[model samples]
Target: MNLANTLAAFPLAVRKFNPRLLVHSPVMFTVFIGSLVCTLVSIQQLVQGSPVAVFSALVTVWLWLTVLFGNLSEAIAEGRGKAQADSLRAARTSVMARRRLAGPGGPGTFTEELVPGTELAVGDIVVCEAGDLIPSDGDVIEGLASVDESAITGESAPVIRESGGDRSSVTGGTMVLSDKIAVRITAASGKTFLDRMIALVEGSTRQRTPNEIALNVLLASLTIVFVVCVMALAPMANFANALPTPVVLVALLVCLIPTTIGALVPAIGIAGMDRLIQRNVLATSGRAVETAGDITTLLLDKTGTITYGNRRAVEFGPADGVAPFRLIAAARLSSLADETPEGRSIVDLALEQGDGQPAQAPEELSADVEVIEFSAVTRMSGLNLPPGYPANPGTRVLEVRKGAAAAVERYALERGGFVPQELEEKVLEISATGGTPLLVATFDGTRAQVLGVIHLADVVKPGMKERVAQLRAMGIRTVMITGDNKITAGAIAGEAGVDDFVAEATPEDKLAVIKREQEAGRLVAMTGDGTNDAPALAAADVGVAMNSGTSAAKEAANMVDLDSDPTKLIDVVGIGKQLLITRGSLTTFSVANDVAKYFAIVPALFAATFPGLGLLNIMGLHSPESAILSAVIFNAIIIVLLVPLALRGVKYRAVSAAKALSRNLLIYGLGGVIAPFIGIKLLDLVVALIPTIA
Candidate 1:
């Protein structure tokens, strides 16, 4: 929309007419060939002193203008990307990075050495501290920090970036706001992710989408049909004793073919990519954006994608015969080495309820203990303490375990402990309400104790119900997939308003779900950020990866969300639907424009040969010359008038495809057929006033 960019388009528009470029568009090149022939004929007629030579020259002028206008529409679309690309280029400035220097002994030393960011190679180590820009896209090998991703996400809020797991990768150009991190550059020079994003947004790397190519094939066939129809008309006119001039026949051919949509197709595509960039999503290909529109099933993970994702422990409930204070102490001990947000929350919650001086940070329990990590298979983890503790063990190392109720119950029975019926009822009560209940129990040498359950609660994100409603309106089924128990998953699915759900799903289940949907002829889209999600992400029709996720997930995904907001998928679906609708509407308009041209030029060209044909001129256009000139002018100017609508795309409403199609057909379809007739008539009246046009 910038005036400067619009002005810059003029030169680019002119260059687009180069024969090499024009040749690629079969429909447009056919028009160009006709225009070229009209030019040669008009020049010859002018030198011959023919009485109707002026009209021929005028017809030739309008033909070239038609081609130029089409070029201008695409150039303007490309220009918007050029302007944005320039801004992104400004952020990619070369700067010095603190490269890690090796110690003479080994890879032990990380002494700093300065090197240009552009010169840094893959596998080279670099360190960045607070207020420093991350030199390249890489994984954090050591340390933790908060990073400002505003350079990409445009959000001012800082996000945590820590070593280990899904949240460790940092993008080039993002700033570290606190602490320091040592990163191993994962991308080579000139091949960074940002460079690819820049190319994509600019549409420099764009290949025609499958649908677009198919549309082009149809359009080309239509053009060929129109050409043959126009050519056959010349012989029919000759047989009727009044053959029209070559210019008029050529004009008829150009008008009948669908040039309006052809001119604007490239522009519609470029603008779609620009819209994605504005939304802070980076799509590797236009095909992904288009595929998103056609998705019938949306597979979303419950953690992060549906709920707030950081599950927090809210309360501890003691089993019958277990002391409340004893349960809290055991719960605290169980989560000591569990660094997951839920585990940390349990430790913090226990400290808050303990009868002691309130501390800002919970102290680690002092004991010689071996940490047992939780696994998706076992669903349990806790500490193995060699008890000099519970004060003097007989011979066994006391084991304190916490996990899913089923897992913990099995563990208890093997150690001579039993879960009280009250505790089992309590776990069921928590699960029914959509809370995960981790059963905490301890086993000493002689006796095993069933302590209690820790309740982990997660909040469903706000506005989710409304967004799900929008998806329903669009006829897209929202399916929530999760590893949570069935009751918990169902409760959350109902609360969130998702259309369907899959509970207790493993990584394999996620892939199986997508495959089933696809096999049923449904296109599926899913959002994920974990390395475990890579295969499912790759299998889905459209995979949207969170920027805060691991590099493996980001690499597998075709689209990346810079804001790391799972709910932003709604905005993405909207943009994708808009792109397809815009193209469809314009193609309808382009075809409709031909009806008016058919009425305006055909009758005027043949009226003299068949006197009764003049009755077809409903507008009472002054002469054959005026009719052809007016229609040509209208055709050239309409492309310009339509540039804004094509770029902004049709206004999207979250209605069913049938309703949306009906609404747009009435507007763009019916309106396109009617408006051109009125416009050509108004222009014919103006042409009648021009003495030279006669």
Candidate 2:
């Protein structure tokens, strides 16, 4: 923050003293009322020609300073976010969109005209060509392209955005790279992804954390008790034949209330969210950030969370006694119509290894062929062709199947073929190395045989094991869930160093795992980017969704990772723990400081009336006037000094919670009671030098 920005907050600080806001902080509200009373008393004393007129004016001035310092702490925290919001808003400039027009037929034609992006409406078709910026959040409906998501994700590499897949959705403000695409805009003007992201990071709609509300209630109760204690003191002084003045009672109440922590609580909450925005993560509410600190178990999917999700075909091996060229043709034929990255990789691997004979183009197949899609339930996906067109349209038409090993074995056996021992051994060898072995088979009217296996390789994300170790040190357990076979899941779980693993998991199995953990009285945090993971994401205590994930997964989550890195949860958890610890340490210090303030002021108030009360002034403050001014100055100045500490949290050490609490208590609780005495005595020495006041 610059000097100009810091000075800009004075107006906001003064404006926050409205009746609505003051009521939220009961301690500050009570002090506000006391300041008003002191103002009225000072004016009355000046009119009556009182002996201590100057002292009354000084007390009233310092009381208002106490409240203003509290408001300044909050305004400083909110200013940091407003500056970042301005920068993000600058990146969302409106541009011209190419409106795709329909021909005499329907919404499929592609002759378009340019118009401002702000003029685009929901469900409207727009054309985005190479080097063009995507005007709004939408899905591609016509062509394929590579999109640079650096505007939102901060990644330099471009990602593919095609018409009919999980990755088709494109965010506004990103640039296109390869080919033209017709997109149907899902959001209208002023409501794009960048707009929501800007709103979330700016903290305009933030709700209070649960811990904050509970602490406010406790502080309000304490304020009421202190109010009653101050009201009874006039009667006690009357019994001593000398009544205390109204300004003296107000000063005592201000010092006794827990104003230090009460002032800094909101600042701490806003700063926590600001820190998350700097780290390129968006939290929907402050409550979710607090929950990250309490998470006991973390449930993560195998793909994209622990390992890179791009499972590609790395090697192709033919079965014993089968020609390599024949097996390569079948693998390519089955994957021709498959749109998944895995399937396209298989086709690419086969095409690179053709023999001397000219290879058959997969597009040359006749109209009788039909494409079968992959499914979780069947555990297989391939072609289903009718006979007489290529092979036999009557009984079988050269069905090429590829899927899990057991699924392919059952398909071959039902067609009167047996699984060879060599094929089984190859599948085991591929799986034990953490590679997914997809079995390819052929079924015809006269024969049924296993062709070969395609080895799909996926790597564990770099540095993920170290991040998992950090979670373990925080006392959180990790579990890996995937649809791969048991052997493949075990290999990944061991390599990732997770605590447990569940293999061959379906969508229902993912939900069941989360429910089982919740039943064991553990708070679970899940990270996922797939549509199937949406249900479990909603069931977990904290669900951090990837920005590259589908809309269903993003909508179900409480937090979103703009960088799409799963390791960011470690930073989020540490931030949550720091927020809780900061609040606790300040609360302890605020209460502890009162013990020293009372010793400085009580004897000074009574020593002139009863000389025997001088024994209580252990620090030997100069006089009643100097003592009162010193105590009030120290009370107000401490709020200003702690503002920086509140903005940047206290230093956090990864250790046991008990040990952490003990160290903070020694610093804040013990030091708070002693520091104020030294500060007040130093100020009293200066006040005594003023001949008019002494």
- Best model per lDDT: 1
lDDT at 431, model 1: 85
TM-score of 2: 0.84
**How many clashing residue pairs appear in each of the predictions shown?**
0, 5
lDDT of 2 by residue, 326-442 (tens): 777777777866777898888777767863323334576566787777776778888866664443212444688888888899888989887788889999999998999988888
The Cα error of candidate 1 at residue 328, in Å, is 4.5
Candidate 1 residues lying further than 4 Å off, grouped into runs, are 1-5, 44-54, 97-103, 106-115, 235-243, 321-340, 343-356, 360-402, 442-446, 654-657
RMSD of 1: 3.6
Worst 10 residues of 2 by lDDT: 388-397
What's each prediction's TM-score? 0.90, 0.84
RMSD for each of the candidates: 3.6, 4.8
Q: Compute the lDDT for candidate 2.
A: 0.83
